[model samples]
Target chain A: MTTITKLPDPVAGGSKHPQRGKTPRPGRGRRLGDLRIALLFILPAMVGFVAFFLIPTIRGIYLSFTEYSVLGDPTWIGTKNYTAIFADELFWNAMAVTLQYVGLNIGFQTVIALGLALLMHRVAKSTLIRGALLLPFLVANVIVALLWFWMLDYQIGIVNEIINWFGLPRIAFFGSEQWAIPTIAGVNVWRHMGYTALLIFAGLQSIPSHVYEVASLDGASQTRTFWSITMPLLRPVLVLVLVVTVIGSFQVFDTVAVTTGGGPINASRVIQMYIYQKAFGESDFGYASALSVILFVILALVAFIQMKFLKGNESDLD
Target chain B: MKKTLGAVAAAAAIALSLSACGGSAPASSEAKGEINYWLWDANQLPAYQQCADDFTKANPDIKVKITQRGWDDYWTTLTNGFVAGTAPDVFTNHLSKYPEYAAKKQLLSLDDAVAKDGIKLDSYTKGLPELWVGQDGKRYGLPKDWDTVGLFYNKAMTDSAGLTAGQMANLDWNPKDGGSYELAIAHLTVDKNGKRGDEAGFDKNNVAVYGLGLAGGGSGQGQTEWSFLTATTGWTATDKNPWGTKFNYDDPRFQESIAWWAGLIDKGYMPKLETTVGASLADNFGAGKAAINTTGDWLIGQYQSYKGVETAFAPTPKGPEGKRASMFNGLADSIWAGTKNPAASVKWVEYLGSTACQDVVASKAVVFPAITTSADKAAEAFKAKGTDVSAFTTHVKDSTTFLFPIADKAAKVDGIMKPAMDAVLAGKKPASSLTEANSQVNALFK
Candidate 1:
C-alpha cells in the first residue's frame, strides 16, 4: 500500500532521494495503475451517485422554479412557488409539526440509546441482546408504523386494552390531533433507538479502556465518570448521531403517512408528508420541489451547526 | 486526476444512456404487437385475464399483457408512466382521476373508436357511458364496471336489536334530526353492561358495539360515508356535474348534513373518527364492533367472506329527498395517448366494455359490469352465491343514484376538504368551518 515519489528538492532532502528515479518511477507508475483499478472498482457507485442523486438534485432545484405537473413539460415561474410557499399557512404548520417531531424523536432516541449503550458497556454485551435491539430498525418503516398503529389503536389495540385494565381511559393515539405527532415520533423512536445505541456503543468501544481505568483509579464515581469522561468523549459520536437522526426525523413521512395521514386535522403532517402530498397527491410538483429545496437547506444548515458548535470532528479522545 | 475524471465521465455517460432507455417509444401502430394492460384490483385480475385470453383468441395478432398493482401504487405508477411515456396501452381508469388525465391530454379520446365499433352508449347502465365523456365532449374511456353505495349491516346484530328486515330497509333520515335511521343505529348499539345506546344507562364511552362504523371523513366526495345523506338534501358538490368551476361545499344543506353526520360521533352511536384511521370499516363491521356500515357494492364479497357473520345489504336510508340516494361510481378502461398500438388498444377496451367480456366479468360476481344485461347477470351471479345485492341494484333501478362528482383539481379539492371534514368529524371545528375550505376549493378553479 506504500507509494514512492521522486523528490524535487534533492539538495534539501538528499538522503531521502538516494533511490529517486530508478525505483520510484516504477512505484509511481504502479500507483497510477492502482488508481485506475480503484476508479474502475468504484465506477458503478459513482455512476449511481451521479445519475440518481446528483442529477435528480439538480433537476429538482431547476423544477422548483417551474410549474411541472408530471404530465407536461415544466414551465418556468421563477420565484412564484417560493413566494406561494412563504404565504402558505400549511407550510408553516408542517414546519412547526416537523420540528416538534424531530425534537421529540431525536431527544428521546438519543437519551435512550445513550443509556442502552452505557448499559451494554457496563453490564451485558451479548450479541443476542444487540440483535434483538436492532430488530425494529431492520423492519421497514411502513411495517413498523403499521405494527405500532394497531398496537396503539383507540379501541381495540392491546395498549388501550392494558390501559383500560388499569381503569384509565383509552388514548386515541393516532386519532386525536394532540397525540398524533408524538405517537408518530414515539413509533419512530422505538424503531431507531437500538441502531443509534449500537452506533454510540461502537464509539464507546473506540475510547481507550485505559482512560476509564484511570478514571476509576482516580476515585471518580459512576455519575462523575459518565458526565466528565464518557459524555465529553462520546461528543463526536453523539453529534454525528444527532445530525443523522435529527435530519431523518425532520423528514418523517411513512410513519405519519400510514398511521394518521396528517391528521385528525393536520396534526402529524410533517414537512415530507406535505411535500409528498403536494407532488404526488396534488400534482403540484413545482411547489413540492421548492418545499424540498427548503427542507434540504434546513437540513444542511442544521448539520453544519451541529458539527461546528459541538466540534464534532475534533475528538477529545486524542 | 484526469484519468479518474475520464472514467467518471464515461461511467456517467453510460448511466445516462441506460436511464434514457427506460423511456422507449411505444411500438409503432403499424406493428400489431402486444398491448400492455394495467389494473389495480387483484380480485378482478382473474376475470380480466379471462377476458384477455378470450381477446387474444379472437384478435390473435395483438397480445395483452396484464399488470396489477395495489390501488395506491397503481395510480402512482400510472402517473409516473405517463411522465416517462411508458404508460400501458390500456389501463383501468377511475372517475376521480380521468378528468385530470383528460385535461392534460394524456388519455386518447375514444369517440371515433366508439362510433366506428358501433358500441351503443345505451347498452350500458343509464349513466355509465356519459361518465366517461370529458368536458370537451370526447370520450376518454368506455365504462367497464359500475358501483353504487349501500348499507351493509350485520344481520345478527340487527335481528338481536329487535330490528326487522322490513324496518331496516325502510329507515329514513333527515339532517335536522337523524330520523328513524338514527333511532335504529342507537337501538343497535350495545354497551358492555348490555345497555343499548337508546337505553337509560347506556355508556357512550364504553360501548361494546358501535351502532355504525365510520369510514374516515370521506374527504370531498364522501361517497359511502355521508354522500347519500348530503345528496338527499339536494346539495351537489359543484355548480355543474363534470367540469363545474364553483364548489358548493359552503351550501347550508351540505353543511347541515355534515354537521348531523359528525354529531353521530358525539352521540356515541358511531365510532370516533380517530378510531377509523388505519382500521378497516368492513373489518370492524365483520368483527361485530359495529352493527351497520354503509359501504360500496364492490365490498359485497368482502363482507360475505367473513365466516360466521351473516351480512345483509339495505338500501341507504331514505333521505329528506324522499328516496334513498347513492353515489354511482363507474370504472372505465381508457387507452393511453402514447400507446403504440392504438387500434389494438381500442379493440381491447371495446371488448372489455362489450357484453362478451362484460358477461364473463359478470359471472365472476366480483363487481357489477357496466353493460345493462351484464349487470343483471352479475346480480344473478351474486344471488347464486347466496348474496342478494338488490340494495345496490335498486339505486339504478329506482334512478336514485347520483354521479360521482367529476371535476378538475379533484386532488386539490380533496386536500382542502379532507382536513376540513376531519376537523368537523373530530369535533374540533364545527361544520361551518367547511365554508372556508369551500372557498379554498373554489379558489383553485379560478
Candidate 2:
C-alpha cells in the first residue's frame, strides 16, 4: 500500500529554518497518474456536456434576449421576451398544470413503485413477474398515450364498457377538464412506475442478508424489521428517484400532446406544451427559449430543494 | 481494465465532438441538376409523384425527389429546413403559412417566372391566383388545389324524420332563430327514449343521437361550423383578405352566430364538446350516431364508407345574405428562395398549376383541382365514383364563396381564439368570451 504523505504548509510561507518541520507529501508521479486517469474517464462526459447541453443552453440564453423566429437575423431585444412570458396568462396556467402533473405523477409513481418493489423482493418467481410488469415501461410514450387514448374512448372504449357494465355513466377520460390531467398522470405512472420499481428493487438487493438475519434474531416482526432496516437504508435511492421523477414530470410534453393536444380549454396544457406552441405554432423562438430557461430554473430549484430536504448524511447508513 | 476504460472514454469524447462538428453543415449540391419537392398530405402524394415522374421524363437532364411528411411535422421540418438553408427547391404551401414565409423573404417571388412562361393566372379558380400574391404584389406560389365546406347528412335519418328534399336543399338560416336549418336539425335529433328533439318528453340530458356535430374546436376560422351562418350576416374574419392586418372576432354578428351554434349543444341538437374527444365528426356520422356534419369536402370520401349508412350531400344553408356561402381555401406549390434551380423549380410549380397536371390530379378525385376545367373533371370523376360532389362545386359555380382569412399573424390569431372558442363550445362561457381574444389578436398587428 502507498503510504500517506504530508507536505509543509504553503500558506505558512515555506521556510528553510531547521525549526520548520519537514512535512511528507504523496508521490508526485502517483498523483499525476491518478489525475490523468480521472481526466480520461471524465473527458467523454465533458465533451457531451459541452457539445449538447452546455453549448445549447448558453445559446438558448442568448437567443432568449433577442427577437428571433429562426428565419432571420436575431435582433437584440433585451428582456422583452421574458416580460411577455410573465404577462401571458397561458404561461401561469401552464405552470399550474405542470406542477399539478408533477405532484400527482410523483405521488403515484413513488407509492406504487415502492410497493411493487417490496412485493417483488418477497415473492418467488420474481424474475417472471418483474419482466411482465416492466412491459408497459418498455413501450414508447407516444404509443402508450395513443393506446390509452383508444382504451378510454367514451363510446367504444373497453374502460367505458366496463363502466357501463357497472351501471355507471360513461366518463370522458381525455375530454373532461376534471379527468384529463389525472388520466395523463395515470398513464404516465403506468409507463414509468415499472422502471422506478426496478431501480428500487436493485437498491433493495444491495442490503446485506445479515441485517435481516440479525433483526429476526432480535425477535423483530416483519413490519418492524422493514421499518427499522429497509426504510432507513433506502433513503438515498428514494432521494435519487424523487429528483429524477420531478425532472421528468416537469418536462412532459408527448403524453399531453398526443392524447389531449392540450385541449378541453387548455386544462392539461403543461409548460412544455406551452413552450412548444410558442416555438413551433407561433413561430416565436425567442419567447420559447425564454420559457425554456424559466422551466430549467424551476426544475433546478425543485431538485435542489428535494436534495436538501430528503438527502441523509453518509453516517445514516451505519 | 481501468486503462481500457480510460482509452474508451477518450475515444468517445473525440468521436462525439467530431460528430457534432460534422453535422453542423449539410452537403449542398447544384439545385437545378436535382431538385427536392415536399408535400404533407398523404392522399395527394401519389398524384404529385406521378407528376414528378412525368416532369422528369420530359426533362431528361433534371431529376426530382419527392418527400411526404405528415401535416404537423411537415411545417416544423420545412421551417427548420429554411433556417438551415437546406429547404427543398419546391414544396407544398398552405394559405395560412405562405404569408409569414413570404414576409420573411424565405419564399421566391414567381412574378418573373409567370411572365416568362406566359402562364395564364386567370385559368385557375376564381380568387385563387390572387390568394398566392404577397402583400408586396409579388406572386410566391401557383394554386394547386382548392376546397370548400358543405353539408354532409345521413339520408337514413332525414328519411325517418320525414324531412322533404326541398327543405333539405333550400334550407335557410339566420343568427336570430336559425330559420329552417334549426327545424331540420331538431327534427333529426333523438333522445334515449326515441323522442325527437322537437317532441314532448324529450330528455336533452340523455340524447342518444345528436342532430349535428361541429367537429374540431371552433377556432377563429369556424370554416365549416359557423362561417356560413356568420358570412350571411355580412361578417368577415378581417377587414380584407390576402393581407388583412386586423382580426374581427369581436363583431357581434360573428359572436351571435357562434352563440347560436354553441346553443345547439344546450338545446340537444348538437353533440356536447366532450363527445368529440378522440373520434372525428366524420367518424361519428359514419357510425350513424350523428345526423349531420358540416365539414370540408375532403372528408366526404372518409364519411362515405357504405357500411349500412347512406350518406348524401346538400349545399350549405342560405344565410340572411340571401345566398349560400362557404369558406374557399386552396393549397399551392412554392419555390424556396435559396433554391439554386430557380428555373427548374418555377417550371415544376407552373406545371403543377397547369391544367395538364391538375387534370391528372382531378382523375384521382382526392381533391378539386385549382384549374376550373380540372375542377369540373374532378366533379365528373366523383360522379363516376357514384359520389355527388355538387354540394362543394355549387359554391364555385355561383361565386358565393368567401376567401379564407390570411394575415401576417394568422398563427397568433389561431392560438388566441382556439381556447376562447373551446370555452364557448363547451358552454362554460358565452361567445362574448372572444372579446379579449380578439383584442389580443388585433394587438399582434400593432
Q: For each candidate, how many residue pairs have backbone atoms clashing (under 3 Å)?
A: 0, 1
Instruction: Give per-residue CA lDDT, model 2, range B169-279, as digits (tens).
Output: 899999999999999999899999999999999999888888987586668888877887789888999998768878888999989988898999999999878868897
i-RMSD of model 2 (Å, 1 decimal):
9.9
Candidate 1 wrongly placed segments (more than 4 Å): A1-50, B1-31
Which 10 successive residues of model 1 chain B have the least lDDT summed?
A: B1-10
Q: Which ten residues in a row have the lowest lDDT in candidate 2 chain B?
A: B22-31
Local lDDT at A152 for model 1: 93
Off by over 4 Å in 2: A1-41, A213-222, A312-315, B1-32
lDDT over C-alpha atoms for residue B389 of model 1: 88
> TM-score of B chain for each model?
0.93, 0.91
> Per-residue alpha-carbon lDDT of model 2 for A1-318, expressed as tens digits?
133223223422354443543432323444566668778989999998776677778778887898866655568999999998899999999999998999899999999999999988887445788898899988999999999999999888999999989989899999988899999999999999989998898889888889899999999998998899998888888888888888999999999998888888889999999988988788887898899999888889988888888873342556
Q: Give per-residue CA lDDT, model 1, range B144-170, as digits (tens).
A: 999999888898998898898899999
Q: In candidate 2, how many Å is residue A284 off?
A: 1.3
